[model samples]
Structure formats: structure tokens, C-alpha cells
Target chain A: MFHRSPIQSFARHGMLVLLCVLAVFPLYWMLNSSLKNESEIFTSSIFPHKPVFSNYTYAFTQMPIVRMAFNSFAVSIMMTMLQLATSLLAAYALVRWRFRGKGVIFAILSLTWLIPFQSIMIPNYVLVNDLGLNDTLLGIVLPFSVSTFAILSLYQSFQSFPGVLIEAAQIDGMSDWSILTRLIIPNTRSTIASLGILQFINAWNEYLWPMLIAKSMNHAPLQIGLRLFVNSDTNMWGSLMAATTVSCVPILLIYLILRRQIVDSFVRFGIK
Target chain B: MSQSLDNTIAPSLSGGTIIVRRRLSKKKLRRFKPYLYLLPAVALLSIWMYRPLLYTFYLAFQKWSMVPGTSPVFVGFDNFEHLFHNKSFIDSIGNTIFYTVGLLPFSILIPMILAVVTDRMESKSKNFYRAMFFIPMILAPVSVSAIWRWLFHPSNGLVNYLLVKLHLIKEPIAYFSDPGFAKWIILLITGWKMIGFSTIMFSAALTSINREYYEAASQDGAGSFRQFVHITIPLLSPMIIFMLTMSILFSSQWTFAYIDMLTTGGPYGSSTNIYYEMYRFAFSSLNAGLSSAAALLFFVVFGLIALGLNMVSRKFAFYDN
Candidate 1:
């Protein structure tokens, strides 16, 4: 299989290796910078002479780093739960039911995906304020909880699920809710897992919506917290990098744990 | 509540009414069952999603900030009419297109090449390279931006240090701060972050292609490059078009967070795109009317561009299994 002509293979492999390095070196630089002192960071060096833990510790104490992480976790987890429940139900109804306006409703919902959040930022701000949800965690969690992409993707999966399962459940005296919980949810595990991870990642990376709605440390997530660190601009590169690394850890961990599922989710959701 | 009682009461009195009641009950069970299943989603999306959308439209025609007592005054199309003549809005359109133009090719082409090459590698090596490239795509954009910001730092940044060390430049070059280079730098960083995603997408698309076609091409004396151009490129067009459309749609928003973090479209708003301009108009200036109008304008223009691209790409995209 490795039978390409030597010259062609060399150029191909050479270019591939070059692109990989280009992609990964910045991450290496960040990890290295997080471990280096200011003087060491300025100097040209491959490795830090003395790795320090001060920056990591400073990132924690100086800002509301822990609080921000907690907020991100709480809101992301809640939003994910809400999303999973809502998306699963909506997908099931959309997949199984022959409602009068189902097609039109699905089309309308999908059209909302094209309406970027920028267009609605001010209106959302006003709505959030009007609903008395502004400056609160609920404010951030609520808008993000119902994702159009998630519903549609899950609907795709649910559409493919055999309908006999639900029919059998109904024959066995099962309510629609029980039929959904007992039948559809169990069968679509992989799709659910992938869509869940996709939604989780999007919610975690969200910046503008959270920034607009959430105020103070009481509700700000990791992205906003990281923004504060950078903007604080104490010329404190070490602390900034450390905070960034900290914020990245959970998602990176999730990405590693479910690498294949995450990749599939990206393609499934058309995120890539 | 009383309407429901009236509905129940009217159908229960006559023989035809009893038949209607049975039919209605069955129909209600079917229709209401789906609604029950969809209740949580419909309620949440209505209040949280659709309400914001409608409210945004409402605010587009009114001048109101977050102030408590101030009443919103409807300003008709003045905000939008104002944006038509506004230089920043026009400049933002140019800058957004500039950013997308700068980022779209690198995002699509480089990754296409990488995936093509990686597909030719040994399975073990392919897995290695895929994992390495995908590591960044999995990380948060905030982390990616922070990493690139440090890497692109003018004096102490590793980029300049490497360039000078390689004897390419005699002095440290300002990357983000320079007005001329800032937008490009932002685009480059955005493209870099996106490269892994596109590469993986292409790789997945590549893996789906049968090996027999390539083997046949090779048997027919096609060179690797020719095989790539004829076989791989044509085959991979759908993924390419999909990525291209998405990248164009999101180029401004993709860099929005980073721009907010690093530059805020600084040095005379050289890096400001429509997305950032919308944020600045709303939050920074507290001008909700102008922001909403700008947002509307950006949507109409961008939506048309996306629709046009979608139409063009439909011709070239292969739907082959």
C-alpha cells in the first residue's frame, strides 16, 4: 500500500508534516508559555528553563476563575439536559406524527437557524430584560436550551427509527410519553450521544449570548471570564494562558473521550 | 378554560353528537398526543427562541436602551436609512467580505490537500496524523484565540521570533496592532482554527470513496496528482461546497469572539465586520435601533450571498453514494 514513487511520496509526506506542525505548534507555544515566566517568554527558547505553577495559581485567585467554571458547568449541564429532553420529544413527534403543520413547522424552525444571533442581539436583550431573566443564569440557559440544529439532526435520526416499536408499545397499552421514553429514546442512543455532545460544545463555546444576558460572576461562563482576563491587560500573559488552558481542559477531555462521536456530531450537525 | 367545557358539553347531547364525540376523541388523542410530546420544546422555543426573534424585529424600529423608565419611540426606517449612508456599515460589509475571502480558500484548499495526502498514508500513520490535526478542532475557540494571540504577539511572540531567527525579517513585525495586517492576521488565525475541522470533514468524505476506483486509475497510468484532480477533487466536491458555504456564512461570526477578545476592531476599525459592528452599535453605543437595523441589513445581504452560493454549489456537488 505504501508503494508511491519515492520523490512524490517525499513531497506529499513533507507537506503533510509541515501542515501538522503549523497546526499544532501554536498549542505547544501556549502550553509552553503558560509554564514560562515573563522573561523566559520574551527570550527565544524551545523549553522553559524553570516551569512555574504561579501562573495557574494566580489565574485562580485574581479572577473569579472557579466561579466562572462552575457557572459554565451548571449552565451547560442544565442546558444540555433541557436540550436533550426537548429535542428528543420534538424529534419523536416530528418523526412519528402526521400532524397538519409538521412540515411547515419544521421548515420554519430550520429557517431560524439562518437568522444569526447578531440580528437578534438587541431584541433578545430587550426580551430577556422584559421577561425578567436578564443578569441571571436562567437567561443564558433558556435561549440556548432549544437548538434548531439539534432538533433537526435528532429528527433525522428519529425518522430512520422503525415505527413498529412505537406501534407495539401503543398496542401494549403504553401512553405516548411511555412509548417515547421506552422505545424511541433507547433506540436512538448513538444519535442522541452525538447530538448531545454537539450541543454541549456549542453551548460551552458560546460567547455573545452569555455576555449579553449574564452579568457579574453570578452568571458569567468560561468564555466571558477568559475575555475579562485578556481585557484586564495587566500584561499578564502567564495568568491569561493559564486561565485559557483551564477553560479548555473540560472540552478537550470530552473531545478526547468521545473523539469519534464528536467528529460524527460535527458532520451530522453541519458544523464543519 | 370555559371554552374547553363548552367544547365538551356541546358534543355530548345528541346521537350524531355522540358519533362526533367518539371521532373527536380519537382525533384529539392523536393530535394532542404529538403536542404533548412536543410541549416542552414548543413552549421553550416559543418564549426563548421565537420571542427574541420577534422582539428583535420590534426593537429594530424603536429607539430604546436597557434603561428602566425610558419609553421606546418607533423611528420607522430611519435607523436602516441611516445605515445606508453610514461609512462604517459600508466598511463593515467590505471588511466582512475581505475576511471571508481571505479565510475561505485556506480553510477549503489546505484541508483538501491534507486529507488527500493523509488518505494515501498507511492506516496507522493516517490515524496518527488525523488525531494530531483534530486536536485543535476539539479545543474551545477562546483557547485557540488566546494561543494565537500570544503566538502573533509583535515583540515577544514566537512568530516574529521565528521569522527573525530564520533571517526572513530584520525586525519584529506588528501583527495584530497594525491596521493593514490586523484583519489578515485575524483571518489567518480563524482559518488555522478551522483547518482541522475541514480536514476531518474531507477525510471522512475521502474514506467513503471506494479504493477500487483509485486502483483502476493507477492501473490506467494516472499519476498521483492526476488521480487527485480527477478522482479525489471531483468526488470531494460536495464536502468542499458544504464547508465553503458554511465558512462564508460564519466567517464574520467565527472571528467575532476573537475580535472581541483581542482587537475589538481597533486601529480605526480595520477589523470590524458586520457582526462586530452589530455588537458595538448595541452594547458599546447603547443604540439598539441602529444595531437592529444594521443587523437586519447584514442578514438580508448575507442571506442573499448564501442563497446565491448554495445555488451555484448545487451544480458542482456530487450526490453519488
Candidate 2:
């Protein structure tokens, strides 16, 4: 409640700063190594003695990174839109309408939250392969269309909406569809946006599912593409770093712009 | 004039009928509207998640290579029998536990202390430190692994380079390639990646703690540590439980991407966890039955733990309300 001593304050600040550095140093190293040549990366120096952009050039030429980025963007955007629409509709229903089996539905959705990807992944792979959707972006995006976390968060936001507003609209003979489209969605735009951004970032960074479903660079997102690059060219640390950095740019940029909203959303939803 | 009056009355009467018709349709729609809205999410989840979960159990008892033109033959308990005896599979269970426990310090203790300390700081410094701490949580895990892979490189890695320069070790250690260090390295990297996330959670939890409690505790002659123990700990216990349960449930998954990118569960299966073991069996070994068996086992074990934690949290968690 009160500052007892300057020494205590100094020590606390020092420890905080030190922890911050430790948290960020690996990322800083990735950026640092990306600018160096092959020779410089092998040395013990922290900074590149002579900065070279050749590694980035090499990364561009060696891999279909542009295509991978495009693929990542497309899948992430599509998944975000789809998840939002589904979540919004579901949340609105669960909150607004009283119905039979609502409790069962909620329990089932909650249980789905605990179902790890590993448990369902094998069968999903089989199903995807059977449907002839393997190595397709649709395969990757379809499985993620119903996010329990998104639905839960949206459910909370929708539940917090003023009941009087909905009731008043109902008395005026306004349709449920119009009430949702005009009043509810417009009011909860920020919440929806936050959830959308979180989902987009998640989809963009998705590695395991994409790794399994996407066979080639054409359908692979940035993460899978980066992994393929590393696996095939393990010895090329420079280009690996360059490609890793490139892959992180879009999400990092989005995070920087929406840092507060993104971080706050995570804190609120605890969605990891 | 009489014809005009009749015309107005006819129009009003028709409008009333139209409204009544719409009302009837709306009533019918509203009865099933919730289900209709929930249909898309429910259908997708059933198709992708719930059905696959059931299929996992089914496949666990059958043999199939996921190849077309072949059906899974029922070979009950054989897959489980083999998985139980398999050395790598058994080791992966231990490794997964090791990771979940090892991550507690990063995900719980350090973050708790950091959150409390930062909470006491001025707003400017607090926000600055919070931003810096959260940077890693936003980075993709694949990129995080790539960065750490370079740092953990045997000869040129910053870790070994620093150790040697500081006279800590005469030679660089092939961290990922060595059996002893590989799992620990994975643990370290996973912990590092999680610290920022847990820190933010802790910070949020810490901020929600009523400051008046601390002031009152101080007036009653309690030191900061005492106040934290008497006040903060009780208030934050729910969050702590929540985080611990999450870490236990998802630790294997958090390490999944990293293990794939950096080690591939390498150096004699030392770094492998249950999740990776499942992946290895399914994709690499093409043994769908064995992988399904592993997934089922993982599901039951962690599912029980999750359920247990849920019960514990309900009982022990102190809600301010």
C-alpha cells in the first residue's frame, strides 16, 4: 500500500526489467539473426557485424513464402468470419431464446472445450482424407468453424445485453432477425472485433492441423511452410531465421496495432 | 363518398390479416429459432469434434491404416496391450507429466510474483513492463521454436556460447541431440513461451484484488508479505487453480509444435510427449490403431484430471462474491 524503502523499489523494478528481457530475448535474437549472413550467424556476436539482406532474398527465392503468406491470410480470414458468424448466432440463441435441451447443449459445448486436438486428430484426418479434402485449405478451415471458446465468449457478451431492449423491440413487433442484426451486433461490435482478431491470429499461427492437412506449400499456412523450409534446409540458419521473421510479421503487426484489445481479450477469455 | 370509405376500410382490414399471418409464422419460428441458430455450430462440432471423439474410441479397438478400400477390423484390446508395454509410449507419459510439473514455476509462481510486483508500480512503468512481458505470448509457437533452436544450437547457439565464454562448460552441448538435456530444453522453451501469458493472467487477477484489503491489513500491522499471504493469496487462489489445471491439461499440446519443429521428439525419444507420440504413431508409423489407443488413453487420463480440478476449484476457490 505504501513504499517502504527505495532499495525495495529499485530491486522490484530491476527484477521486472530483467524478466522482461528474458521473455523477449529469444524473439530479439530471431530478428538479429535474420539480418546476418551465414558466416555471421555461426559466430558468438550478438549483432551482425555487417548486416545483409541476402538471407531474406534467399528465403523469398527458395520458398513460396508469398504463396504461403497468402494461404495463411485466406484461411485465417475465412475461419475468423465463419467462427464469428456461427458463434454470434449460437450465442444469441442460447441467450435470447428459452428452449428445450439448452442445458444439454451447453454441457456438450463445455465438454468439447476439454477435447484436445490430439484425441480427435486421427479420426479427423481419416474423415478429411475420405472427403477428399486433404491438402486443401477448406479441410483446415472446416474443422475450426465451431470454436467452443468463441461461442462461450460471445455467449457471455450476449448475455450481458440489456433484456429490456430486446423485450421492447419484441413489443414493437420487430423480428428477431432484425433485432439481432440492427441492435445486438451493432452494440457488441468491439467484443466481436476482439474475438475476431484473436481467432484470426490463432488461425494464422496454427501449425499442427495445417502441418497434417496441408501437403504442399500451395495450401500450407506460414507456420507449416516455415517448418517445411526448416526441415528441408536445416543447415541454412540464416534463411530459416529470415523466413521465421517474415512469417511472424503480419501477426506481430496486428498485435502491435491492437495490443490492448488483443491482450485484454486474452485476459478476459483466457483463450489460449 | 360511400365507395371511398369502403375502400379505406378494405385496405385496413387486409393489413390486419397480413399482420396476423406474419405473427403466426413468427410464433412458429420462435419455437425452434434457438435450435435453428445453434444448428450450424452444433452440426460442425458434432461432425468434427464429437463424432471424431467417438470414432477415436472405435478406432482404438480396430486395425486400419486409414487407406481407402480397407475397413477397420475389430481387434479388441490388442492396441491397448501393445501401447501399455511399449517403452516409448510409457516414457512419453512420464515426459508429459514432467513437462506439466516443470512448467508450474513459469506459469504460476514467477508470474504471480511479477504480477504482484508490477501491480505496485506506477501506471506508466506497469504498462511498459506488462507490454514487454506479453510480447512472446503473441508470437507464433513455430517461430518461437525456430528462434530457440538457433539459441540452443551446439556450437553457434547463444546458450552454449555464453556458457563457454563464462567458463561454465569447456565445450558446447548439443542440447537437443543429447538425451539428458533435450527434454529439459523443451521444458525451458515451453516455459519461456508460457511465462508472458501466465503473467498477464496473473496481472489481471492481481488488479481485480481490492486495494482496500491491503490498506486495512497494513493498518493492522501486517507486512507486505503477510498481507499478500493473508489477502492476495486467498483472492488469487481461484485463478491459480484455474491456471494450474489449464497447464496440466494443455502442457503436452503447448509443447507439440515446438517438439515437432525443434527436436521431432528426438535423441532416443527423450523429448517426446504423449501428443507427439500419438502424432508419430498416426502419421509417421501409419499405425492408426496404436495412435487411436494412445489418444484414448491420453483423453481418459487428462480428462479425469480436468474433471478432478473442476471439482477442486469449485470447492477450494474463493470467490469475492
Candidate 3:
């Protein structure tokens, strides 16, 4: 493509800058509001007259955000690890083995993808109560242990692995376990990492499930805890904002570090 | 060693006994290996996925208060009749449609333009702008709702402050609390958070489009805008349809969170949608039968819309690869 005239280039640049501002200004306002006092927040000045460090401190004491973050971290980590292991094993079986009813099993698994939380909330609540897993981390992670999308993504990656490599491993007198661990695992690190991060983020941001299961701050994830804060104290905008920022910082950092790999993984997997 | 060889020959009725046993064991293991590998995930799914789904459908026909010592009564079509006759249910359906209509343009069109504009920048700058656009997508939705709720606050909010400073309004406008403005404010916030995902999708779609198309357009004396209209748009139609379908499906889920956080279906049900109403009826009001009936209706309507969209997209979408 040829370059446009200088005036045209300038106009294009101006428009791009405008788009960035539109995308980012509300976030900027959020941070600004968090740092301001009640008077400053009410006044709605672009800059706070007096910056308050107490808001950040107040978030810890007021909302039990630390406990909530810890809970979220524990549940997300558990869910992500479980999802990875289960999805990998399932994908491996589907990819490597041929048997009767394999296609039917895959179809049945994919049907679960259409099953939203709203559809299953009533029965899941009943099941959780009957099992006495309510108000427990196990309850939060159990229902989320396996996702059909994760299994499909990993299955696709495994299918794309070179057949010759697996044959070579077999020729070397390697067992199935050895072939899976040494051959396939090393080759699919990028896909696994991307899926792992995605699963972790999904678990971390989940609200409705945790709200149903978690009885207190002990098991409540960050989303539910943030809701608790806004509901409990109407005057604690500063602390509430601090808590919100704290919950978001980790995922934002992960996105920044893994942007390319994650985007490419989704593109290849064709996941919306 | 000498003694053992003699004993081995004497004990074995058949030669190559070790090899025979090994082959038999391998055959047996191979028969069961796939199932063994799938056992853990299958067990979890049975307990978690299949059981709950079946039980939920069963519970739909029974009236249970979700409390102990309450016997479930079988009420076949009564719940369905009640849900169909309820005015709130109808209004919620309308509200959901209104929000979807309000959001579809901002979610699809604005981000497409942003993606095009951002892609025109140098590669290094394009990466930076891409990151900036995707910041909201990574943030927790609850936090995003809280931030927007504050911004849209009638008094002591930045939006009103800005408007007043610009001399656009003499007084502050109550956004979320006013029934007239509540739904639109929710739509705006939903659109804001969604732009990131849509922009990234479109940006990737744009980049994947071949520059040779542009070269051909330029040779024909077509300007950049004309090339975008004729070449880029046609090439990107598949991605456009894909994202549009996803946005429609996702609109219900995303708005559920916002409605839960900010409005709680307030201002006389202005912010209420089917998703929220279902939650309220099932959980708060303990009307499981009515909620199930509502859920079935929602599924039918949304399912038809999705199927219709899929069929329509087949005609317009161009698969470049």
C-alpha cells in the first residue's frame, strides 16, 4: 500500500488517538476516583485536591480483600491445574485411541458447551447441598474441573502433532506413558499455557457459583467479595476501588505478558 | 545360575513362556488403556455435569422451595401458564431485545472502525494500541460495573461533572436510578467493556486479509476508503458474522452481571432482562416452577435467533482461506 498525503496521515493519526482516549478515559477516571476523598470524589474534579493513601489501607481492613484474593487464587489454581490434567488426559485418549462410540462421546461432551450456568443453577445447588460441599473450595472447583472447549483445543493440538515423532518413540520401545509425557507434552507447551491462563482467568472472575457456594470470605472469590464491599459500605468508594484494582492487577499483568500466545491459541482453536 | 536353567527347562511345559505372557498382557492392557486414561475426567463429568443437568430438568417439573422439610409437588403446565401470562416476563423479553439492539451497533461497527484505524499504524505502535484496547476485557466484570456505576452516578459523578463543566447541562442527570435512562446507561457500560474483545477480533481479521487485494484496488484508481468498502469488507465478512453471532449469545450473560451488580432490576424493572428475572424468580422468590418455565421459553426464543443468524450468515460470509 502507498502512503497517503501528509494531511491525510495527520488526520488518520488524530483519529487513532481519539479512539485510544475513548477506550481508556473511563479507566483513568476510575483510578482518579479511587485516589480521591469523599469530598474530592463528590466534587468530581479531574485531579484530587488531596491524595489519600488511607483508601488503599482501608480496603484491607474494611472488606477482607486479602482473604478474598487468597481464596480466589487457591480456587483458580486448583481449577486450572485440574482442568489441565483432565483435559490433557481426555484429549490424549480421544486423539490417540480409536474405539467404538468415540464420535458419540465427543458429541456428548461438546453438547455440554451449550449448557450455561443459568440452566443448571437449581440442580447444582441441590447437588452441592446434598454432598455437603457448600461453603467449600472443593465445591467451587469441582463443577469447573473439565471444560469441553479446553478438551477440544488440546485434542486439536494433539492431532496436529507429527505422526512420525510418535512412531519414532514407539520404535525406540517407549511405553504409552513415556510417549505422552516425553513426546507430546513438550510439543504442546504453548497451547497448554494459553489454555491454562484462560482457565485461570475464568475461574478467578466467576461470581454466581461462588456466591452460591461460599458462605463467608473464606471461600468467596474476588468478584463476590467486591460485590460484598459495594453493598456493605456505601461511603467507602476509595477502599472499594482499591479492592477492585487489587483484584484486576494480576489478570492484567498476565494479559500483558502472554498477549500474543493467548490470542494465537484462540485463533488456532477457533474458540469464541 | 546353572541350577536355575535346568529347573527352568524342567518346569516350563511350553517354550518361550515369558514372551507369550508378555504379549498376552500387552494385548489385555491395550484393550483397556483408553478407558483407563479417560477414567478421571469421565468420573468428574458424571458427578458434576451429567447429574446436575438431569436433576435440574427433573426439578423443573416439581415445586421445591430449596429448603429442608419442603415436599416437592408435581405441577405440570401450571408454571408454564403463569409465566406466559405474567406482564413482567413479557416486559423483560422486550427489555432484553432493547438492550441487544442498543449494543449490537457499538459492539460491531465502532470496534471494526477502531481495528481498521489501529492496524494502519506501524507494527510497534499497533501492538501498544491493541494492548490498550484489550485492558478492559481482562479486568473482572464486577469491578468494571462498579467503576461505571460510580461514573454514571447522578450527583458527585465524573460524567455529570464533565457535562456541567462543558456547559452541556445545567443540572446533574440521574442515570441508573432514573427508569428512562437506566437501561441505556447499562447498555453504554456493556458496550464499553465489550469493545476490547471485538477490537482484537477485528484487528486479527484485518491483518489476516491479504495486502494484494489493496494493491489491486489501488491499481484500479480506488482510494483507501473505497478499497476498504469493496475489498476489505468482503474479505472480513466471515469474521464479522462470527463476532456478531457471539455478541448476540454473550449479550445475555454479560448483562446479567451488570444487572446483578448495579441495578438489581431496579427503577421499576427497567434494567430487568430474562436472565435477571429468572435468577430472581428461582432463587429470591423461590418460584422454581415459574423460573424453569421462563428458562424454557428463553431457550426457544434465543435458540431460534441463533439458528436464524447461522443460516443468514452462510450466504454473506466469505471464507478467504
Candidate 4:
């Protein structure tokens, strides 16, 4: 690395620190505002004069927050599991098996990455409506069951796996399914977990599709529920902040726990 | 083909015909197994993704209000003609371009600078800075919008409150309601949400650049800026092109959730992008034909841009073998 003068290094650090504050200040402000009463929230002070727990209490009373959080959690988990399973199977086949139309299939799947969700959303709504899945959790989950990006990333990872190991397993009388599960899957655990976390976070923050399908509170995910809560209770700033905080907690916790893996996955996958 | 034929012929020649038959059948089953593995994902994708895409194109050429028991009617070029003349649609297109151009500073330029700077720092401090920068990228967009909505509040918001205290403004500005401020505010918020992600990507790209190039440049009496320009940038050109293309493509969608939550694309639709406008058409107005047309237009425009970028990237992006 090139050396820098002390003054230049100091200035760089200062700028970076300032940017970091700007990056994190919104979440800080949210947590701070959530703890404040309505009067305190409106004031210009950086810290709450007297932090109160009442906003959270009011938030729980006014909204089906527990239920919504549960809905968000269950939907994200199920979607993650579904995507991982499908992606793993398909990726294994694409990498290990030579089949007719494999190139055509891969090309078609890659094209899905170019087509934005909005392009297909109207027809998808119609499809969901026909299936009578609207206003249900499955409605939100079904459409996202296949992820082209995940499969492609996993396929790339599997391409680097040792073929000798697969041959060794085959000689030991291991079936293809057994080789995939007993060897490939275990070796690529970090990649699988990284993709899973990425999918989970995406599903949790999913708004437009979930909003379209889950019209009622019972099936609404955290993002939609937060929107509805904000719309219906416009003046309850403290409680709204509290509810927003609740919605953000699970994602924030996941990010904190697996920060490196998540970033690595994003970089590897070239996903936004 | 020859290998399989040889297997059958050689087994028959060796007089192990029965055993060969069983093995051949098993080989056939093995050949079919990959298809079985691929079927679920392929089926799901075709029904959910491919079918809807075709249906979108079809619906674009038809007229429908999505009324119950009413079918879509064929209307060739009518939707496109209407969209061309529609004031809001034109404005939304302009706003989409504006968001894309406005995001460049946050998504590409600043992130590049930050990535280069952080790359030279000590390891522990580098990790700390990276984690801090990446925090916003991980936060949910709805919550990010909620916090900013409060921060941009006219009377009681922190931003306005700070401005007044600093004597920057005599009065608080209604950021979301003012047509001039609404689009820019949304842009700024989108940029803030995106910067960390782009920075992380840039950092990853930066680390992959071999240090020997930088050292040799230094020995050649090149300054830091010169080294960065000649060595760092050329090596990082591929990622730079990628980030630029991604920013342009997804900029409209990036601002959608925030626009929905923060302003609802308000103040005379100054902040509305095509994505949100399509949402309004489909859900609010129930104008399925108009929405499909818009979505199709969006796809075609972005698809062409993607194609062009592919060509441009091949020419400009430097790949070290």
C-alpha cells in the first residue's frame, strides 16, 4: 500500500467517521424517537429528556404487531428454505450432470434476472387471484419460490468443487443424491448460509408484492403492517416509531450476527 | 452417442447381454435424473416469471379496466399512443431519468473514493469503517423511510430544527410537499440507502487489485493520484462499469418504496417514477391495460439499456488475464 502523510490520513479518517455517522444516524434517531413521548419527539433535542416505554406499549395495543412480526418471520423463513432447496437441487444438476437442453435452460433462467418484478407483477396478481391465494401468506411466498440469481451463484460455487471427491464417493457406492447431500452440501455450508441469509433479509423487507397479496393484517408482513399502522395512525409519531423499530429489529439482528457473510454473498453474487 | 453404442455392442460381443441390459436401463435412468432435479425450479420459474412476462406484453396491446367478469379487449397501439401524450407519464419518465442521474454521485463516485481511501488504512480500522458504512444497506427500507419522514417533517423535524439552530434557514421547509424539494429529497434518501452497498462492492473490487502494481508505480516516481489513475482505476474499470450500469437500471425501483412511504409521489407527481406510477395504475385506478403498457415500456427501455451497456462494458472494462 502507498504511504500517506499524517495530515492526509487524519483528514481521511475524519471524513470517513463523519460519513459513518451519517450512515448510522437515521437508525439511531429511530431508536431515540421510539423511546420518546410525542412531545419529546417533536422537540429539537438529540436525546430524549425522559425516555418512556409507553410508546411501545401503545404500539402493541394499537396494532397486531406480534402477529405481524410472526407473519414476517414465518414467511421469510419459508421462502428462504424453499429458495435454498430449489436452488441447491438445480445448481447441483447444472454443475454435475450433463443433460439435453442444459444450455437453453441456463440461458432462460439467466434472462429472469433482467426482467424486473414490475414487468410481470400485474399478471402475477391475476395468477394469484385465480389461485385464490390472495390475502394469504402463501401468496407472498409462492411467486418468489425460485431465485435465478441464487441458483447461478450456487452453480458458480459448485463448479469449483473437486470432481475427484465426487468420483471417490461414487466408487464407495454413494448415489448421486447421497453425494450431493453428504459431500457437496457440507463442503459449501458457508455459501449456502450466506445465500439463505440474503434471501431471508430480502423476503423480510419485501413490500410491494406482500402489500399486493396480503390485504389484511392477519397475513400482512412487517413492512406492510408498518405502512398500514402509519396510515391509520398518522399522528401517533411515538408509537409509529416504536412499531418501525420493532419491524427493523429482526433484520438488524441478523445483519449484526452475519455481517461479513452477508456482505461477501452480495459481493459474490453481484446483487444490489 | 458413440460411447453408448460401444457399451451396448461390446457387452453383447462379450456375451453378457442380460447384465448389459440392466446397466443400460440404469444409465438411462441416470440420464433422466438431472431433469427430475431441474423440473421443480424450471416449472416454478416458467409459470411465475416467464408466463407473466408474456402476458404483460399481450396485455400491453389490449385494453382492460380489471372489472370483475370483464375480459380485456384488443386495442392495437392505443395504450402506447395515450402514454406518449399523457403529461404524468412523460413527467414520470423524466423523474426516472432524474433519479438515475442523481444517484451516480452516491452509488458510483463517492463510493469509489471511499473504497480507495479505506483500502490503504490499517486492517482493524478498515473493518470498522466498512461495518459502519454498510449499516444503512442492511436496514429495512420502510424503516429507513419512516425515520427520514420524521427527520424531514416541516415543523418538528430534526433537519429543519438543525437548520434553524444553525441560522441556515429562518423557517422550516416542507420538504416532501414542495415540488422542487420532493424529488431531490427522495433522491438523497435513495442515495443514502444505496451508498453503503456500492461502497462494499467497491471495497471488494479494490482488495482484488494486486499491491505490486501500486508499489512499482510508486518506485517510478508516480504520486498517489497518478497511481490511482493509471493502475487502480484501470484494474477496477470492470466493477466501475458494472456499478454505473446497475445504478442506472435499478434507480427508479430503488426510489419506489421510499416514494410510496414518504411522499406517495406527491406535489403534483414531481417525485413519481414509472414503477410507482405503474403501481398506481394497477392497484389504485385498476387500469390493467395502461399499467401493462407502462410495464412493457419500462422493460423495453431498460432491456435496450442493458443491451447497450453490455456492448459498452465489453469495450471499456479492463480484464487482467
The C-alpha RMSD in Å for every predicted model, in order, reads 3.6, 4.8, 4.7, 1.9
For each candidate, what is chain B's TM-score?
Answer: 0.87, 0.92, 0.88, 0.94
Error of 1 at B42 (Å): 3.0
Write candidate 3's Cα lDDT for B68-184 as tens digits: 668678988777778878877778988888887778876788888888877877889887777777677667778888888777777767788889889999999988788998888
Off by over 4 Å in 1: B1-26
Model 2 CA deviation exceeding 4 Å by range:
B1-25
C-alpha lDDT of residue A136 in model 3: 91
DockQ winner between candidates 2 and 3: 2
Q: By TM-score, highest first, what's the ranking?
A: 4, 2, 3, 1
**TM-score, model 4 to reference:** 0.96
Query: Residue B317, candidate 4: how far off, in angstroms?
Result: 0.8
Runs in model 4 deviating more than 4 A are A1-3, B2-18
Q: DockQ numbers for every candidate? A: 0.65, 0.75, 0.57, 0.76
Order of quality (DockQ): 4, 2, 1, 3
User: What does the lDDT come to for candidate 1?
Assistant: 0.80
Interface RMSD of each: 1.9, 1.2, 2.0, 1.2
The number of clashing residue pairs in model 4 is 0
- Binned by DockQ into CAPRI classes (incorrect, acceptable, medium, high), candidate 3 is medium
Question: Candidate 4, B283: how far from true, in Å?
Answer: 1.2
On DockQ, the leading prediction is 4
lDDT minimum window of 10 residues, candidate 4 chain A: A1-10
- Of models 2 and 4, which has the larger DockQ? 4
Per-residue lDDT for A165-256 in model 1, tens only? 77888889997777778777887788888887877887888888887887676568988878766767647888788888888888878877
**How well is each residue in A1-272 modelled by candidate 2, as lDDT tens digits?**
66558887888778888888898888788888888887788886778899999999999998899999999999999999999999999999999988899999999888876788988998888889889999999999989988989999999988889999999999998988889999899999999988888898888878789889999887899888888887888888988999999998998888888889998888878865
